[model samples]
Target: MTYQDKVILITGASSGIGKELALLLAAEKARIILSARNEAHLLEVQAQCLSLTPHCHVLPMDITDERQVQEGAASAIAIYGRIDVLINNAGVTQRSKLIDTSPAAIRKLMEVNFFGPMMLTTALLPQFKAQQQGQIVVISSMAGLFGYPWRSGYNAAKHALQGYFETLQTEQPIPGLSTTIICPGRIHTDITYSAITGDGSAYGAMDPGQAHGIPVDVCARKIVKAMRNKKKLVLIARMEKVLLWMKRYFPPLFYFIARKGN
Candidate 1:
């Protein structure tokens, strides 16, 4: 559970939960490697990390690019000699009704939300296996737990990660290797604004659910604790926590309730 001296790499570190996590972990004395597509935003995050702690570095790269993901992983290993934690937090969302969803829109979501993380994890798996000790943390959504209206592609991608990572855990049971899949209900972030719209533009709006879900700082702390404790699955949010349990025990009722969720 000790974070001191551990090397942690986080994608989507440019802003929101990822940036908050970087700052928190840096303050805990963990060596941090921040990666995202925006060099400018990455630098800003790196600066903030430096202000909090000196053990922080930036490796800006587009997660959607396999080569960049590989290079970024190499850079992290080169910096700290090894990676103790890899947080797959980079993802994009889209809000569109199923009937209106286009092939292109779904592909875009898959590229960033599903394929990007899959590629990044695949690139890191070798090192983790060789060491027999590493943590892979995935930032999924409650949408992954159940289908949500107006986010067909988004839900599918997250659901895919949950399936793949969970199976990866059973298929490759490396001693000391750990995977934690996080399903967050909502939070006040720019995620909605950045979410792809039906017309292929940013949504540029906020959802009330996200506005009142949880604070980013609180969520970051919970995530760090879960990672350090090596939790296999962690669901965060007041109402979503209940839904998580329901989905496991009362499938029929869970489906009915989920159908009623907005």
Candidate 2:
């Protein structure tokens, strides 16, 4: 679908994929609503978006807060009339072994990565159903598709998202309502450094896989294309894309290799 003048709300808009996506969509002439916890950073991203597009709104929101998420959804509708798209891009990653991760840390990840998006989506669903036309894009990860090492909690959260969105897609029979789940192998984002650690501290360092992953702009562009096409699941990055198909059709081999990594 065309994005011109379409209202799109993106969480985690301060930096990384969300920031890049805001810029990309703004250039497409979409009305962008930016949301994140850091008001300062939201302003920073707003400035960047305004430089690119004339229409942009900044809504400082902490997705972890259900009240704030509901309010933010209302605010976006008030500002733009209707939300054409809701991008569940706000999420946190954990980089720790299962045993190393504390119960509190696991809860924190689940709150931000799973429950936060779920709440936001539920709050917005009424609006979408009323409009009878809306798109929900989930910025999931390859970790969601397969179990990975040292990321049990993170994997669990993303996996949950995949299940939820996939089910939503199946349940939604209306041609106008849609969902897209993006499984990116790795993108050049600071997610690793910002990832929560076992001790509940930031990892504070980039991982090699993330550093060498596809560029954020490239990944965002691909996602936009997939969203417009109304794809249920889109996997970017050649290696990871291949791996996803391998895991689906060649489960035994995938499990064998995956076990070696573990």
Candidate 3:
């Protein structure tokens, strides 16, 4: 279960959790492929990873674009002739209520958070099937499990993401393929700064909750451990784990608390 020499592809590798994961795996001497829309940031992360392992490569492309996803998947597989793990960590969040959010804004969130990962996973299925053993790590959110205020589109997209990947988990289309869905409550990352508003513009400000969330490096370590264990589902959270329990056993309280949440 070691990461040594394992060819792993991670999306959203420019910064935050993705970058942390890249560096962690690189330290373990894994063959790492970093992907993200920002080439400059990817290069920066690549340089850091290369210092740890010589097997680091960067493939910059927009996950929301289908052509880029397909090409990126091919390029990733061509890197080491196989991809042992694919981490679908590239996603954007929203920060507006459903009523205030425009249709296009919601669509944009769906494209990046839901369709992009699905498209990339689909494109890589053949390669995984050929290898007969591969891991698909999906970075879903706690919002995927239940409703939350000020994140209407983000909630919808994450829920859709969970549904899609969960179905794949049940279907077991690829006998040797494993899927791990990670539902993180909050990790102190700059994700809030890039969160989309009702009109599809960046929120550009960090929320109070994000400021007090778990550390990004801690979250990345937990994710890598979950991937190593091939866990079916993992929730990285504190109070949010309680909220999920409330949702399952105490619906009234769950809704009451959710209504007041940001």
Q: Which candidate is the best by lDDT?
A: 3
TM-score pick, better of 1 and 3: 3
- Give each prediction's root-mean-square deviation over alpha carbons: 1.8, 1.7, 0.7
The candidate scoring highest on TM-score is 3
Expressed as tens digits, the lDDT of each residue in 1-262 for candidate 2 is 5688989999999999999999999988889999999889999899988987888999999889988988888998999789999999998887888889998888888898899999999999989988999999999888898887778888899999999989899899556889999988878998888799898899898887788889999999998899889898988875766666779999887777766543
Per-residue lDDT over 146-230 for candidate 3, one digit per residue giving the tens place of the 0 to 100 score: 9899998899999999999999999999899999999999889999999999999999998889989999999999999999999
lDDT of 1 by residue, 50-165 (tens): 98777888898888888888888788889988999999999888877878878888888888999999999988888998889989999998878877678888999999999999
Model 1, runs deviating above 4 Å: 244-262
Name model 3 segments beyond 4 Å from true: none
What TM-score does each of the candidates earn?
A: 0.93, 0.94, 0.99
Each model's total of backbone clashes: 0, 0, 0
Q: How much is the lDDT of residue 134 in candidate 2?
A: 92
TM-score (C-alpha, index-matched) for candidate 1: 0.93
Off by over 4 Å in 2: 173-175, 249-256, 259-262
